[model samples]
Target chain A: MFEGREPIYQQIAEAIRGEILSGALNEGDQVMSTTQYASTYRINPATAAKAFAALESEGILRKQRGMGTFVSDGAPEQLRSSRRQSFFAERVDPLLRDADVLGIGADDLARYLLTSASDASSATNTDQNNA
Target chain B: MKANGTATIQGYGVQISDLAVRYGSTTALEGVNLDLAPGRIHGLLGRNGTGKTTLLSVLASLRQPHTGSVLVEGQAPFEHEVLMENICLIRESGDVIGDVSAADALDFVEVARPSFDREYADRLAHSFGLDLSVKPAAMSRGQRSALGATIGLASRAELTMFDEVHLGMDAPTRQKFYDELIADFAEHPRTFIISSHLISEIEPLVETVTILKNGTLLLSEEADDLRRRGVTLTGPTALVDQAAAAQTVLGHTVVGSRDLGPTRQLTLYGDLDQRSLDEAERAGLQVGPVPLQDLFIHLTDA
Candidate 1:
């Protein structure tokens, strides 16, 4: 669902990018048409089309003459690299700054992250063992 | 029922060229020009008595322009039966005749509008939780509005318009109507103009937004572009002022401030570059968005 902030089209583009990078959508997979996206999400078709156009410009999606839009061959890789570049600025940097304000050092955060990761793997292992 | 009749206007493009309407000395609309493409939902937004109804009435051929003209599907829609038949305009009361039951009113559309489909009307009515057996006079305002919505949608004219069609419906009902409209439009695909004071209610549903101010065309643009006309910047007063100094600030206020530091939120109108936004963000300022309603109010304020 789209919130009204920062234009819905931009969010749509970001969402498609996320989907491609997360492997939910594979390269060469036919994505939803603009109208289909609009109907499914209940957003304006124009907004949906604008997002698709943006994706096309970024070489993420391609539109065939008769057929619908398909994820470009290098879409997932392209998105991954682009997202990787921004991940530090948009996500990691903010978290690090917030932790700094809370008087949490980088080493402490790293230690916490290690503990969280071990806990997650152990939880998965327990599920597998139970199964 | 003019079934085997004349022209069937296939396209739903609307062109209002210098459309001006007046009721005697009182000027209703002046030199209003708008170009609405085929099969797009347009939101006609305006303040009270800002000629929203006048524009729609002119398009519906309910009242002719005293000075200008309106073209739907490349021809003027005056007494042109073919064009008129292809256009359905439902006003705020949902256009249901008071004397008849909702079912009868819908059935009447089937007789009058060659494009009206009874099964579709029934389905929409059921989805809207409307009882077809209830007369418009006896039905609640919400039910009547739902019936009107059902009729307007089921008619499926090449150009179907609803003027404040959500009149007395609750928030959830209006939302349901919008959802239904989106689903139906995807399947049918026609030009739909919805006039409403509730800009946010219809903003997401529309592709194009035509705003009227004091009976004149203020601005018309795609809703996607129109919604970006304003941006909100929130930060410390000094930094916010420095960043917003060169921009056109429509409104600004101090949302949070201490004796030592004052944090301000500035609503800026017009285009802004990404570089400026990045600079502001780097200065520890949070960039936000102006809601459609706020923008409309700001743009239309005297």
Candidate 2:
């Protein structure tokens, strides 16, 4: 459900990417029909179709001759690798550099990360248990 | 479709680069760049006095951008007669000669616009119950709008732009305009740019939207992406903050029984995870999507 902000093609690309990342759309899962997506989302079928086409181009999704689009087998791992590469470039490296500038020792950073991770894991477990 | 010897339909990408213009002291547009594709309806969105008219004028080659160029098919629109002929810029007033009857104006348009189909214009006028003998000055505001609509539909310009042509029309007329516009586009594909303040009303027609604030392009986004990108969250400030952490916020306000409680209406940009969405709902916040109008106001308001 995007609004008019960035180019719709890019937005469509991101929507498909989100679906893949969430695992709700698994490998070989048939992507939503473009026409159905268009009506349900109240967007132009052409635009919804553009998103699907982009995914197909990226090798994240593939289309059958008579059937609809299905998630590619390698899509998950490929997306994971690309995201991981971007994560290091966009986040991890900058964070480490910031820590170095702040004169935080490696050991100190390790402790902080360990503690935060533990806390997050425990919170997630507690939430899971509650659920 | 060819109405005369010349073809009315010619699709081309519009690439406006470093476009700047000023009207006396007012900066109508400044250093604007847009790459609008062919055959898609683009919404030029802005508040009152935000230079939407100026940009459209430049695009249509009615006026030149002071510093840059409007490119139709990679050529300057002002210099390209064929490209200029393919654009129909329908203004709000649709100011035709007062003395000329509606039929005369339509006839003139048919001759002036190579693509104007006389038969189509006549059919439309007949369908709308428009009297050909009625001069524009003698007609009601709605009638004038109808005439403009007729011109727009009949022009069949590759790039047909409507700038608030139905502002004063009734709701039914506006709805009719929307339906007719969509149906016409399906039959005859072209690039349509509609500049309107009625965001929610015309949101369905716009495939992509470019928003301007103080003559600057703030956002150029697809309608679908924008819907997915923004969310409205309401709850305690702490809970809201927690849910909205790491998210870009468009705007937020307070709402409660006291009218001055914790922040209740928070418009966030970026997708919220399932946990975050659930947390927001659990915090007694009515989490939902914000409309484009609200987002526009939030983004443009000082």
Candidate 3:
């Protein structure tokens, strides 16, 4: 699950962030302990601990004295806002760069975006209607 | 499972200074100095006859260094009963009782090593598909290795060193051994110095890496730091060459330039800063991390 160029700890922290953002791990939910992560992933417990420490420092995960680690309250919302804050720079700028390389103007990119957005909404609407 | 209470015995830290070992006319190791911090898995990597085994032997106190001093937990291990008892070294040769059944061999270890856990040993043997009733002499080479792994794990010594104990185990058995090692280590943290040629397989399990080259200490550093130090850049030959000019380029290869216009993959050994990485990405260069195995190969290349 952690096949990445980045350090394993960073990958682990990113994975937890993804889980929180996807609503798979709700706020206040107890996460797996470092020991569990170590055994399950076959990684050093110290590496897992480092990941946990980073998350704790970022306020994404909080440790209760002796009870284990849990997702900090409002972590999901906090992550959403921060991700939203970086969305344009991290996502759209890259898309625009690729478009520029392809010689596609902003107008064509906007048109394509609108088409795909509409298609996505229509698909969701179809699912709702069927339900 | 109840805590063994031996958790209080934190792993032993090792300090080796100017260690040298020789066999008559041959110098096995020279001027080796290293400090292994407590309670972490250290990967000892080197090619054949690069003094990997000799270093381990000195640490295990099987053979004294010809010069320099060695300390385990701030005390010399040779002839030091307490320190020696806490240090266990298991080699690929399966240094267990070959004439007796595996069960008896384990029983003997339990009696010998104060911290040996009989239940865990039995569980490990079962997981590895080792028949306890069979003597080591009658068992397959893979089974013998499994027995060695079982003894090493069950010993639970403060400073445990496995000198390529994965030698004869099949792929599945080796995987089982690794899993068991991690699981047991999580419960009971201790120092582990694992010497293995299977660099990639042990990459994730090791936090520290020590490489030996030609009877000398090459590099000893955190595994993550070493991983970050090596970067593989693949792009147009001109762009790759331009970007890698200031870096320590380890090796390069040109492939599939017929259709893609002179592409080259350059493996550089140095920290490529974030700005440089970003620039490379913007330039459409595919940058990848060098696997530990590849880095080892490059670093120890003769």
Candidate 4:
């Protein structure tokens, strides 16, 4: 379901950005029409249209007029870089704050992050070996 | 069916002014003014006996207003032949001929409604799993609701309203109806106003919202705009009071203190930017969004 704590339009924009970043929606590929999204998600058409307009403003999506909207050519890299910049503010700050609440120092938090990253990579390597 | 109308009529805008209705000594609606734009779904939200049905009934010409005026698609509706024909109102119950088969009832629509599309109706019936062979009175509650949805969607009138038409549907069936409504609206753009107490369920389905309380209009705005009306903060009473000092406090409710301090949660109605949210967070207060339903309940506090 597209329903969430955030506004539906913001959620819609994030979904499209996720798709673009993950390469599910390739560069220059046409996205669903507003009508299609509205019906598929059972959301208001204006909300869907609002999401599209936001993506267009961010240059992550472009319009083809009669053909409808499409993922922009530079959308993947654009989204990746933008997400990377906001990652610290939107994600890492909250993690650091939680660690601080638990009486963990910054160095200890950094150590924890390192170990978790290595553990994650090792798990992925094991899975690859199994495959 | 032979008809004397054009192929399609665009969606109609609804305008009402000083409209009032009374049932004997009781008032159902009073001095209500609303403007519903064409080609968008408007959610008419209210508690029971809030005049939602009374307003829709008047628009559909089921009854005349005791005072004032109503204009549908820019023309008066009372006894206005063609204009009345263009409006369809589907109720929660008792709109159908109970003794007739569902198919017969739909057939009746074909003859009575100049714009009825038989194939579309049949397709909708199949989609809804409607057993058209059974009489309306014999059908289950859910099936009757499905029939109501079928007619509401397939009618294709210029202005179609559903007054809690999703009442008896199960979750999946209601989702199906919502999807069908958006799809049908896309395929044939028209004005639709759905009245329901299920605010969250209908929130995403509507672009415009009209909330009623005690037979009067409370607030009417775009659904998105309405959702952005408030942010609720819960913390120490002094801190909460300080944070909400300049804002419009919709209401405040007492909450448990964190550590022997008097804590009160207050909901403020109106816009608050991200900086304000951050300020609340910095002040150690928990910030939460006020959903449309909560806003409606507060705005229509009774």
DockQ of each: 0.44, 0.07, 0.60, 0.43
DockQ of 1: 0.44
TM-score of chain B of each: 0.91, 0.86, 0.92, 0.87
Model 4 lDDT per residue over A31-122, tens place: 99998898778788878999999999999899986788999888887887888987876678777767787899989878878999999989
Residue-level lDDT tens digits of model 2 in A1-131? 56533455567778788777866788889987876665556555567778888889999999997898899998977897889877854567657767887999899999999999998989767854753
Give me the iRMSD of candidate 1, please: 2.4
lDDT of 2 by residue, B1-302 (tens): 34543564435678988889998887899978888888888899888888899998888877878797778767888867787778888888565666789989988887888888788888877766678899988887777877788899888898898998886677877776776676667557788898888888787678888988888888887776666666766666776667666353433232112223755456665554545565555445557766877767777877
> Highest TM-score: which candidate?
3
Which tens-of-lDDT digit does each residue in A24-113 have in candidate 3?
888889999998998888898889999999999999999998899999998977888899988986678777877898999999989999
Error of 3 at B32 (Å): 0.5
How does residue A67 of candidate 2 score in lDDT?
94
* TM-score of candidate 1 against the unseen true structure: 0.84
Candidate 4 clash pair list: none
Candidate 1 residues lying further than 4 Å off, grouped into runs, are: A24-36, A56-74, A89-131, B1-11, B246-261
Error of 1 at B30 (Å): 1.3
Docking class of 4: acceptable
B55-120: candidate 1 lDDT, tens digit per residue: 889888899998877899889999999889889998886777888888788878899898888998
Docking class of 1: acceptable
The worst-scoring run of ten residues by lDDT in candidate 1 chain A lies at: A122-131
Clashing pairs in 1: none
Off by over 4 Å in 3: A101-103, A118-131, B1-7, B246-260
TM-score of each: 0.84, 0.66, 0.91, 0.85
Q: How much of the true A–B contact set does each candidate keep? A: 0.45, 0.11, 0.62, 0.55
